[model samples]
Target: MSKNSKDTLKISGIDTSVLRIALGTWAIGGWQWGGPDDGNAIKTIHKAIDNGINLIDTAPIYGFGHSEEIVGQALKGKREKIVIATKAALNWTDDKEKIFRDARPERIRKEIEDSLRRLKTDYIDLYQIHWPDDKTSIEETAMELEKLRQEGKIKAVGVSNFSVEQMKSIQHFTQLSAIQPPYNLFEREIENDVLPYAKEHSLAVLCYGPLCRGLLSGKMIKDRVFQGDDLRKTDPKFSTSVFDNYLAATEELTQFAKDTHNKTLLALAVRWVLDQYQGNIPLWGARKPEQIEGIRDALGWSLSANDLKTIDEILAKHIKNPISPEFMAPPNR
Candidate 1:
């Protein structure tokens, strides 16, 4: 199990230390905002850690390096206490060898160095390939990761947004310690491949988008008119009629919470993912204090058998798989 702090939840496994609940910082860097404001960004990150969250996730591509800088700023003095997980893939260019793309080993080395400088850390706790480059042999990219780990630059190696076959192929480089993918009540595609593979291999499965990109937060409604710049506008689930369908389904779950007076829709959504296994750690992203505040009620509880069956029934009736072609990261071409 885990050492339960008043604010943080810690879960340990055979391989490494796992913080059951962690702060995923993409939200503060304006994942939804055109760009996140520095003051607010600092506050939210500090608040998450202050509230006992010890792990943080970010990627170089998030806001074109802005997110990392913000994370570095937020964790200035508290660096040693926090476990940071960041990724490299889909750089400014695809030349991994050319200082841009996935081809050059030199580029990969430079990118890690640059990330270290930006992060203000001598070593990263978990370093992940943000996505796989299909152009190069998976082994070729993994070799660079192994090199980084050998240099004491990173504690563990992992991959984000990888398929089962891709993860297995990369594992040939060495034992991969973790795998990051999207998993939520609304999106369960990973259940069929990624989750089982992680379980069989003893790899950490970090579930990003645990809030379903804010849909499961119980904020967006069916008929709401979204402005042009919002990411949700492009999300199919937010489409006029489609959004209503999603809301209707969530409404049922919300009602269930009321019936027991025990859970919020956000808590139920988070608990549903956690219920899948002991290794599942949902990486929660928060934009403001309120966003983090909304999900706090979800912690410290588990769903009952009837609750689990009811959730499945609601999803089966109203939700379809939302994994679209756009959601799939394009192969490094």
Candidate 2:
């Protein structure tokens, strides 16, 4: 599909011309995924934009402000062409290694300012609470974001990793434009409630980890080893027996893509996400320019009912030990 073929979604009355895919900067942040080269990260951002992707999802906690900085540098003169969707509320201690949720009104105020400085933008297109903070009342967090919206600091208010009840509670105070949730073939906990609720409430749903942090990229092998601060080293899906099961499933899925669609597993994985729900945007993470090349393939085709059934059968056949991305969650405090 052409760039124009990508659909648009409206959030909080703002007309956003977004592709089916968005560029996620979590990996570029280089905190959890692995150490990322600064030059490569900036190039990846440019490549995504050049390839027709308009929305870029980032967070302050990513690399403790490194990812946003790289995004700012990449968009120095090209900011007008892209939609910036960033998150706040998750803060780090002095050491920066221990991070926790803090959506207090005062914390939100400070976070927006810091994010603005790092992103090199006066007004953010979408500002989301990185995670729900149990320490602060949801009402307080919503009111703070509403205030920021009124002040023109953020165009839309959103929340990430929030439950249905938490969403309802916040909606009582202010309008929620979107919700960011981890939704991939392996991690689908949000489909039951978060996704349906967002659709019912007219909130845009942006699903992150579209490739399950590179597991569905069709590159992981049993012998692959992760080093440094790479999260895959500790990810449950990457464990011994579990990794074998997932790898087996991925290999079958990869073969299916080659035989059925004449595409790569990366394209098939993202297309499956787009076909599963209406108005769902899959946030694709990439740390290198070459990684964005598959965006076009993911757009033009979709999965059929039979294909979906076959995919389920493949998962059931090989993945005896399935795992969710629960370890990535931040502390409630």
Candidate 3:
């Protein structure tokens, strides 16, 4: 790809700069990941934008609106230069501790307004349903999103955590611009169908957790302990024998990166996701400015067929017990 062409991805008639990678604000929300410092989080967002990353993916549930607020503050006068992608249909209890999925018409209506306010934008570049609510018909949700699109509140409509069947059901009501799903070397359930469907339909694939929630970052150690609220504490992949298996795989993957490309496992992991599938955008999450530094290394590199085969062999050799991220799914209400 040419330098200019590689720097941007056109989806739904909007050109989003892919110069670095899309910045993910889930960690800055400071809920499941850990506590976050507002100053650091804001600086991290600035650093990402300064470094040429122009796409940001956030959700209202992320820190219960805190992430959007931070994003709004970060983009104070630069909103037009960046593309904001936020989600809806996921709400919290009155106390704001528990969260559930609700995509009813009334609920989505309220969510868009609230998200617009928190994001400090009159219109969102991309609005997505955070999850598939079992209680609401997919058509109903799609209709509401289509209504918003018509009204100019949102420029494009997308869905996250949706299956191929779910996307098909929603497509009957409105054209999908993108699909956000958890995709990385470890979690690849989408590769079977969702990916092919998106490609066939010309919908962009915005992949979340590109580093497997930091597992593929190559920073995790077997003795590491997570706080009570940390999502990884309860993640099956982090438990006893499973944690060891994953760690072993990471060790091998790290060596492969050094031997092959002289790059960090973090860069290798992100590059793997981007190269494995065409037009697959990885949402790289960061809470500190330093965490955003390695994005440069992730670019300008492509994995060869032999490199991909070696990665598969490494995964198959050490990961005797593979775990899925099913636990992160919210309850349908």
Candidate 4:
């Protein structure tokens, strides 16, 4: 693959240069983030694509397929300009309360058709397994995904929230070219294993949650109540004492960003992620058009080694007892 720009990545089988940042649609799905507004969601999608972001990272379980429906609606005319990426392997019941892993071959067959219909596209640029299904062998899932590729339903096979061993298992069976793992300033667990492995294997790495679920955005006010179905309500980081730690870190980080880099905390967080690995594309989540504006700040600069050290020192100063995002994983049934 040939890349002409440092700001873009050449994903396998795709001719276009995918932007270094992707639009994450989980928040707009309105499932775990409260609820969705179709009009604004459509606007946000258009704005991101129009602003030069060519990659969209979404999933079937997000808002129970509502997000894809909106994405389908938004991409009616701009379809060719965007590299639509969505995921499967997770299933949900009618009550909207229970969701679990289900990567049976039969399930993936149905998932491709359903996703194609919902996305209003004849082919998907990338099809990803959302999570590892303990009940289904990785080889079984890879064979089914490879079948879809053979049928021209999907251009490339990808995996999310998967370990290096699981990814190797998929490679043993068929093509596995891309991987999406939780990666951000505070959540850098992938650096130890996934990043090195992906870099060695020439796999695309789409790092999600660059803003750490909006915590790095420097907008979460103290004592703010996240009512409704907001995931923050139960997130361990947002609990009383821990939240105070985050609050202080956010404030200091915000000041550090403004004073040192003349950038917002959101931009600092995103650029930090991108600088970790030149090819690493951080997925930025946004539910509104205004939320997309700050991304411009993230791209125009690079962080220095000294600055990185200072940032780490600041995080260590306040964010004691840091946590990972593993709690959000769905149980395999």
The sequence of per-residue lDDT tens digits that candidate 3 reaches over residues 1-333 is 225455357778465544436999999999887776899999999999887788899999989999999999999999999999999999889998789999999999998999899989999988999999999999899999999999999999999999899999998999889899988888878888988888888788888998987888989877888885798887888876777788889999999999999999999999898886666889989999999888888887688999999999999998865677899999888
TM-scores, all models, native as reference: 0.89, 0.97, 0.97, 0.97
Q: Residue 254 in model 1: shift from native, Å?
A: 1.0
lDDT of each: 0.73, 0.86, 0.87, 0.88
Q: Which 10 residues in a row give candidate 3 its minimum summed lDDT?
A: 1-10
Model 4 ranges with Cα > 4 A deviation = 1-4
Assess candidate 2 and give its TM-score to the true structure. 0.97
Which candidate has the highest lDDT of all?
Answer: 4
- What order do candidates take by lDDT, descending? 4, 3, 2, 1
Off by over 4 Å in 3: 1-4, 15-17
Residue-level lDDT tens digits of model 2 in 1-333:
463453555566455667768899999999987776899999999899888888999998888889999999999998877789999888788988688888889988888999899999998998888888999999889999889999998888888999999999999998888899999888888878888898788788889988998889988778887888888777878866778788889999999999999999999989898887767889989998998888888886678899999999999998765687888998877
Please provide, for model 4 over 1-333, each residue's C-alpha lDDT reduced to its tens digit, 9 standing for 90 to 100: 113266688898777779898999999899988889888999999889877799998899989899889899999988888899999899987897899999999999888889899999999999999999999998889999988898899999999999999998899988887999999878888989999999898889989888888799878888788879888887888866788888898899899999998999998999898888877889989999988897678886788999999999988999877899988899887
Report the C-alpha lDDT of model 1 over 154-188, residue by residue, as the tens digit.
88887888888888898888668888888888888
RMSD of each: 3.6, 1.4, 1.6, 2.1
Better of 2 and 4 by lDDT: 4
